[model samples]
Target chain A: MIEFRMPSLGADMEAGTLREWKVKPGDTVERGDIIADVETMKGIIEIEVFDAGVVEQLLVKEDEKVPVGTVMALIRPAGETAAPKPAERHVYETFKSIVNVKEEIPPVPAPAHEGLRASPLARRIAAENHLDLTTVQGSGEGGAITREDVEKAIAERDIRLKPRPAEPAPTPAASTENIRMAVAAAMSKSNREIPHYYLETSIDMSKALAWLAGANRQRPVAKRLLPVVLLIKATAKALREFPDLNAVWENGLQRKAEINIGFVISLRTGGLIVPAIRNADKKSPDDLMETLTDLIPRARALKLRSSELSESTITLTSLGDDGADAVFGVIYPPQVAIVGFGGIREQPVAENGLIGVRPVLRATLAGDHRATDGLTGSRFLAALQQLLQQPETL
Target chain B: MTEADIKTTIFQLLKRIAPDTEPSTLGPTDNIRDTLGIDSFDALQFIIALNEKLGIEIPEQDYGKTGTLEQLIAYIKTKER
Candidate 1:
């Protein structure tokens, strides 16, 4: 029996609440089939199964907050027979002991709080903040105090108990705070663990932008291509020449075949998610724009698929039209490099002994020093610039 | 579809695409993007919905002409004719 555990969606996700299971015992699941909806710091992420098998048992119940790597279910592989009940129990107990035995034992509901119906996440958050559960009111189904309720109480307490400082207050929204915490943890881990080398180049985007404008003039607004699409396409094309930069570094540098470029999209509410446009190099500029247009809305709505969340080989972040001229990004863990595109601006350009005003974009590369060198990164940038110069090709 | 029928269908489609948007607040001259806060992606979905529901092929070039409620209705009406 193969143990299906709660996956670490990102570096920061420690535990997740299983919101709902899409499958049950005896249901056959494919490798990439979404088996459950897991609520993490990222939001409701559809969890995909990696193994093709018949689910033998569902170990965790819906709405239980389980730590990362906690076994959520047992799957019997296609050829393998169902293990006898006694033997399965023996294996399960041994496995649980091997992987945090204490977590395997569910928290027994306290007798004093017999009628209290708090979510596991709420309980954990309440304990962390030293809040009394009885005093806090529940807004969830049947008077259950959710994570949001605990966070609300914490925010209120902070305002009432302490003298206000001049500093801007952090967002009191529980989900937003959770997202910020997750991002912070991931960024911290990335900074601590990854030795990063940064390189940047300003590419004259005059030709690319001109071409895009001309192209867009011909198409309807709905079918028009954005400048960002060209940037993504160029970046993906450049990865072909500098494959080392398009890789994930675990034990060693592992090169990915498909050039899936994850674009960092900031949400309107706050926080950001990097969902990839798969096989970006293979797609035309128009196709990439269509994909991006579809992606951004769904991403903001928190409706991204499991593969979209997990399959990025490299990341590209473009600060929209009003952003700063340059951005040095932190590399998301697993992926070795992150490409940042600052806002395109009209700048003075001197080319072939002639100085003229041209639209330019600042492209910065933050690469894992362990996986690639500065020379490799520079070459990648050169290719990207060359591709942008030849906009038609992209 | 009649002009009134087209308007109702478009409203239904818009509601489906952006349920939170108040249809009554929108006017003929109001820009859908500005009024509804719908982005290019949402607009593309809207176009797709129109195509599926009305069986009209809106060329990419004409997308610019369909920004307002009046513009969209006129564009669809012209295409249908």
Candidate 2:
């Protein structure tokens, strides 16, 4: 039997509420199959299972909030005839819970005759919000209370207590503010702990844009590539050479082999999310453009998968089109470096003989000083510049 | 498609790209991107959606010709023939 647990979606996620289950007992599941939708601070993310088996039991019910690493289910390996019975499974779960104190055991419901029949989730939320269970109306089978019942009670109570007019049911602004707060907490933690060193360089983008324009002239709008794709590929290729900068700082530097670049996509509402384009170095510019185009809309809608949010080795931020001349970013925690690209601008440049106007891009690197120094950052920038100058090679 | 049909379809596609914007508020001759506050990515998305909805390929050079609602309708009408 294998245990399926809640995954840590990012450094910011502490716990996630099991919004819905896509699998049930006796259903066969393969690796990478989405098993549940989990609602975290980041939003509802489709959680993928990493084990191939028949699901034996679901320990947590829908709407139950559980911490990271809390086992939500057990999977019986394929071709197993005799799965654990309910009695044996109960003993096993009891033993496991004894060993893992953080795993919250559901409160045993009272006998139906006495009072207050509610699911464990309803009870927990009521206790947390200081709501009286006696006042809540049950909406489940046999009038058993569920999480939705308690939530409705809370909303009604809020409406009653407040003197203002009726507020909308779904508060997009409130959720946006929650995202902003989460971002603030992560960035503050990054600022507090990471010892950051900054580096910047200006690269002339005349050759790159010329190549892109000539190349795009033949392709349709849907298939044409963006300059950001070239930047991402160049950054990933540069990281292949400068291994020190493409690492995460745990207790020490943990260098990653795959170049997963977390490209930051800002939402129109307010905050931003960085989702990884996995194995960016291995992908051609066309593939990079396709992946980026697919990710941007999903990222804006807060519909990213858990792996895409969690697996980035390095972060890349580009101020596209309308932003300032340069961007010195803060290094995200665990990530040792962040690469930033400023908007491409037309400026006077001294070429071989005379000064002329050329499109210039200012690229910045924020590196964790504990993992790498300024020299390593400088070389990485140089490599990025060299790669961009020959866009056909990328 | 007639001009009215093309205009409605274009507004619907723009609504998909920028879900928060009110497409009916846009004027006929106003710049679609700047008035809607959509960036280059969104502009590209709008173009792709137009192709999917109208079954027409918009070239890079013709992007300037389709800058407003009236112009986009006219461009799509010409292509519809």
Supply the TM-score for candidate 2: 0.67
Model 1 misplacement above 4 A? A1-15, A19-39, A43-59, A66-178, B1-81
lDDT of 1 at A19: 81
Candidate 1 C-alpha lDDT tens digits along A313-332 = 99999885657899999988
Chain A TM-score for each of the predictions:
0.66, 0.64
Extract clashing residue pairs from model 2.
none
lDDT of 2 by residue, B22-41 (tens): 88899999998878877678
Strongest candidate by lDDT: 2
TM-score of each: 0.60, 0.67
> What would the DockQ be for model 2?
0.31
Residue A314 in candidate 2, Cα distance off native in Å:
0.7
Q: Specify the poorest-scoring 10-residue window by lDDT in model 1 chain A.
A: A94-103
Count residue pairs with overlapping backbones in model 1. Answer: 4
